[model samples]
Target: METASAESVRKHVRVYVTVFVALMALTLITVTISTLHLQPAAAIIVALCIAALKASLVAAYFMHLISEKKLIYAALTLTVVLFLVLMVLPVSHFADRGL
Candidate 1:
């Protein structure tokens, strides 16, 4: 029983390590993207996409959301939806400026 528990812990640790590496890679990519002189809209889109990916990874691995119950998943989904709605609303404000 102890060995099985240890194996499960090791699996979790491996997942954490993998996500950490991916987070690092995403950070590097974001940095590189920022150094480029992209159009403001494009840059914002890229940065937001990278941030979303990092958030997803952290939520899944570090927060153990992937293994959580359906109720938790539903809450997370609702949070993401709310966040998207809040973020996208600002784009309309920009659109009014003819950008």
Candidate 2:
């Protein structure tokens, strides 16, 4: 088993604190945006964008995925690509409709 030094521990703590602060800020911003009287479509898109960003932050930091191996990163990338494809499929319903 390898042992890390005090400095390394402190660094990890600092990163964790930063991540926490960022997550809190994102949460606050999302809440504030939701309260605004945006058009339905715009509000939905904006909320989805914020949700995606928050998910990324949680996955990267809270999940410790930022320190993961290359294979994990590849998997994460693929997952995001698939997610995007799925997200766009619902838009086809609006294509034939008159705005």
Candidate 3:
């Protein structure tokens, strides 16, 4: 039993360290992308993609969402859907501006 506990701790520490390293690497990649001076749209897209990935890592590991229950997933899904709707509304309205 004692060995099991120690092993669990070691595994958790390794996961945490890996997450930290990944987050740092993503941050460095973002900085590198900015310094590369890519076209505005491409840069924006790349940055947003990286930001989303980083956010997911933080949410999954740090927030303990990876082992979350179904209710949490349902709520997060609803939130994301609502957010997308909100984002699309402005774009759709803009498309009708010239009508």
Candidate 4:
């Protein structure tokens, strides 16, 4: 494997630190929102959105996915799509049962 240049290493470190800080800020926001007495559905939605953002940052920076090949990206996209479909299936079933 090619050795990374010092500048490149420094850039990666900076990016990692920035992502860490953002994750931390999102965590604080999550806690803050909990105390704000938002409606149950709204709170769940906001928390899930923040969690998704944090997950994205973790995947991109910590997992080194930001620089991955196209094949990896395509696989990741497929995984996300399948995950969403799985998640929605149960909800769709409940909705159909209610009708």
> What are the lDDT figures for the candidates, one per model?
0.88, 0.81, 0.89, 0.90
- Rank the candidate models, highest lDDT first: 4, 3, 1, 2
lDDT of 3 by residue, 1-99 (tens): 124477777777788899999999999999988999999999999999999999999999878787778898999999999999999998899889964
Looking at candidate 3, the ten consecutive residues that score lowest on lDDT are: 1-10
TM-score of each: 0.77, 0.70, 0.84, 0.88
* Model 1 regions lying over 4 Å from their true place: 1-4, 88-99
Q: What is the Å distance of residue 15 in model 4 from its true position? A: 1.3
Backbone clash pairs for candidate 4 read: none
Highest-scoring model, TM-score = 4
Report the candidate with higher lDDT, 1 versus 3. 3
Model 2 collision count: 0
Q: Give the C-alpha miss distance for residue 67 in model 4, angstroms.
A: 1.5
How many collisions per candidate? 0, 0, 0, 0
Per-residue lDDT tens digits for candidate 2, residues 23-95, read: 7898898799889978999999988898888888878776777678789889878998999889787786676
Clashing pairs in 3: none
Of candidate 1, the 10-residue stretch with the lowest lDDT total is 1-10
- Which prediction has more favorable TM-score, 1 or 4? 4
Task: For model 4, give the 10-residue run with minimal summed lDDT.
Answer: 1-10
